[model samples]
Target: MRRYTVSTAVTLCAVASLAAAMGPASAFPAAAPPAAHAVQQQPAPPVLVDCLWKPQVHPGDFMLACGDGNSRLASLRWSHWGADSAQATGTNLVNDCDPYCAAGTFHSYTVTVRLDDPKPWAKNPKMQQFTRMSLVYTDGRPDGFRQTMTYPLWS
Candidate 1:
């Protein structure tokens, strides 16, 4: 009984050694390559989150004033939306607030908008949000702002 057990073990070891010497190619067939016409899906680009914490890409409008909706970007036509940055041409609508915010008049100005400096949002760690916004006034700007202005966007 002992001799038979030893003989079986030696035979199994010899078979394993033979298989290893033969290599993987002879032991198993190679996998086929992917179809040439198969489309490769790209990853979604980074986004800007609104006050409600909803991600947006190439949005037609975005609210700048989260507290009161007094200022916003309107009619945004995005020229570029990429992982690192985004650019758009739009109208900035700001409330003049001559007397008070409640009865303020909204004014429109033509502007070029840029969003960059992407970082992980606190609310959603998996999502990337643009943390910086820069605007260049092509036409009339708001009373207290320069021709070019940059602001750190909230996460």
Candidate 2:
């Protein structure tokens, strides 16, 4: 597992560098690659979590992929293909991770957040209930997992 993690971390850094180097050759065919917008790199040992939105609210699934530690919560890329078909890849993707080697071993991960300046994303009356807390991800493949819990936040 340690070797896997190390290998994945190195690969991600290399891929991130490649992606950055590739530039906007494919994104914008008409315009030359924009130099103003820097290419975003995949973080090293980046652990990530999938956003518990969309069908998860209805289907209730909670599974995540562990990257490393250098990836950002918002930068870890993801995709939901529906009905247990999902895939995510990033660096240092270990939002909530642990070491395990036995059968049926359960691991717990937690993130604590504090309220800062108010943001419009939570201003909507329907979203006000979710103000200070957020559920983000590492690699966003969550098909067989299940939802555990969401905490309370005080304004």
TM-score for each predicted model, relative to the true structure: 0.73, 0.17
Best by TM-score: 1
Question: Per-residue lDDT of 1-155 in model 2, one digit per residue for the tens?
Answer: 99999999999999999989888676756755667558765322211123433221211223332232222322223443222223333322233232332222332333222222222233232222222323423333223333322233332
Clashing pairs in 1: none
lDDT of 2 at 46: 14
- Tell how far residue 38 is off in model 1, in angstroms: 10
- How many backbone overlaps does candidate 2 show? 27
Consecutive 10-residue window with the lowest summed lDDT within model 1: 35-44
What C-alpha root-mean-square deviation, in Å, does candidate 2 show against the real structure?
26.0
- Which ranges in model 1 have alpha carbons more than 4 Å from their true place? 1-41
Error of 1 at 40 (Å): 6.8
Runs in model 2 lying further than 4 Å from the true structure: 26-155
